[model samples]
Target: MNDDRLEGAGGEDTEEHLLRSLPGCIVAAVGMVGIAGFVLFLVARIVRSLTT
Candidate 1:
């Protein structure tokens, strides 16, 4: 919002830092869901195999 803030040499990296971290954050969330799904699938397969 302030001009001095943006022109300053090393005041902040808020936007850039957020942009940089976005991909890693997304990957981590997706990876967690993927792992959970895989585990559930494995459990379902094991249950099916045991029942039949």
Candidate 2:
């Protein structure tokens, strides 16, 4: 029943940890989407070249 043991070792709670990591998570998500888009674009270009 000790709350201190339940909290983070750095004294920050789960919400605080998520808030601090939010920006990095956003950047990672955006980068993944960008890479996926680029790959799809390349695939489309290759398909178009093969068809034409």
Deviation in angstroms for 23 in model 2? 0.4
Residue lDDT tens for model 2, 21-52: 78989999999999999999999999999999
Q: Candidate 1's residue-wise lDDT over 1-52, tens digit each?
A: 4644454446476666667668989999999999999999999999999999
Once fitted onto the true fold, the runs of candidate 2 whose alpha carbons sit more than 4 angstroms away are: 1-12
Error of 1 at 1 (Å): 26
- The reply for model 1, stretches above 4 Å from the true place, is 1-12
State, as a TM-score between 0 and 1, how close model 2 is to the true structure: 0.77
Model 1 worst lDDT run, 10 consecutive residues = 1-10
Candidate 1 similarity to native, TM-score: 0.66
Local error of candidate 1 at 51, Å? 1.2
lDDT at position 32, candidate 1: 100
Each model's lDDT: 0.81, 0.83
* Residue 26 in candidate 2, Cα distance off native in Å: 0.3
